[model samples]
Target: MAQVYLHTMFGNGARAMQEAAGSRASYARMEANAGAADMLTDREADFIAARDSFYMASVSEDGWPYVQHRGGPAGFLRRIGDNRIGFADYRGNRQYLSAANLAADDRVSLFLMDYPNRRRLKLIGHAHGSDDPATIAALMTPGYGAEPERAFLIDVVGFDWNCPQHITPRFTQKEIERLTAPLVDELDRLRARIAELEG
Candidate 1:
């Protein structure tokens, strides 16, 4: 039978469960909390630096949620002030889910992960799309330069660091290989068909 414990408003939820189980050695467990005292720690800065991509979640005018992957230079995220962060928007596919959502509602959430490090960062904030020259310059990278007309400014509110135990990292090279292998095979098959048709 799965053991059940009453939800407590204060204290660590994991601790409460352990206590209810009389500190039994058989129950393997760790701590869980809605708001922990040290939820945001020093590791967040490092995690953000290592993250190459992130999912940006926004809400549309009619209350629909949209999520898209935004990736660019390493330091796309900048610390504007204490407890506040800003990220530049790079050019993407024509579908601008994030931009449309920002226009309707500024409230947004960002989930960034460093596959190699297995670390993740969650950020809640208000975001705005911008075409400002300064902002574009700041976000541009060596090979992946940002378009002057396609950039955004984000204002972060709450930030949290999550445990990395469950995460598995996918390297940049692996991602590229996975994306191209199928296309290359398809091209080869198409060429064979073309040769047969010509013959």
Candidate 2:
């Protein structure tokens, strides 16, 4: 639900914009509507499980926003508790930008997209990095070869689903191959038939 999401994001600046745009009344009602955002439902859990990658944004000490794209095998970002999820953070370019930012501020926002379906989920959470071997190993994916430096755990505070408008549908290589499998099979059959006719 957008209950907590709207409340968390609709600051004075946002409210002023909404008022100027003449949408503040409706938005205010929405922000006060009934719902809890601190728990994960089945829909959110399933969506999170299916995501192979997500964009995490953190606040720098200077108040600048740093967004990083994190990727792994699907389901690598799994729920630890009802409202908590974590992933194994692989060693990257060693800038340690996100880790450094988290040390100062635990606030983070996450964006998970399903390009093929043109769907997106937005999350607001408090996150921190843990070097506990058990935590890192629990989040690690089997057969994945990435060297994990730590586990980044998030306690989700709010979440909302975004409209699919303007999202260009896209597919990964594995998705493209899956979609064209029947065509490949038909092509192989046609080639076999042509060979038999020539014989």
Candidate 3:
């Protein structure tokens, strides 16, 4: 039988051959030893009470990956059960890359970052879409009306703390200074012009 070949943007056929050979060799080495440690560790329920944003990743039928951002109030992510989680899928622009990918493949990865605390959480799970009234109610956000066109229930297999050492912490002082400096300067100039006008 003739061998079939696949091409990618990395390079010509030679690179593909090298990558195939390298992958097999790498897999052999990895198979010799156990894999890395489990991603998640136990955390206080209150820990998630502060996060308002999460990044969700899903894969298309063709194996391409898509990531989308979901954000709202604290505890937007609720523990449905042990090893299970639920979050609202707020209405957005008609494009639903994550939802479409979830329909094709249930597996997903989620990342949550609490910027003020410099903390992060990563979750790996299987996702299922739902339109049930109860499920929708559980995931709804205030001012967001009811459930979106669809929502997701994730059967979490792993939850992990993302390292913060590499992430530089952002302080409110610096943020305020950066945001208000120009406005403050402009206000001072305006006040000076008003004083001149009154003088």
Q: How high is the CA lDDT of each candidate model?
A: 0.65, 0.92, 0.68
Q: What is candidate 3's local distance difference test score?
A: 0.68
- Model 1, which residues run further than 4 Å from truth? 1-43, 174-199
Ranking by TM-score: 2, 3, 1
Encode model 1's per-residue lDDT on 87-151: one tens digit a residue: 66655676877777788888887889877668777777668876777766765655664554555
Which candidate, 1 or 2, would have the higher TM-score against the true structure?
Answer: 2
Q: What TM-score would every model get versus the actual structure?
A: 0.60, 0.95, 0.63
> Model 1, residue 127: displacement in angstroms?
0.7
TM-score for candidate 2, please give it: 0.95
lDDT, ranked from best to worst: 2, 3, 1
Model 2 alpha-carbon miss at residue 188, Å: 1.1
Largest lDDT belongs to which candidate? Answer: 2
1-199, model 3: which lDDT tens digit per residue?
Answer: 0011011112456555756777644533433443332322236245655566688899988898888887777778777676677877767787878878888889888887766667777667789989887787777766755447766898766555666777666555656788889999999999999999999
lDDT of 1: 0.65
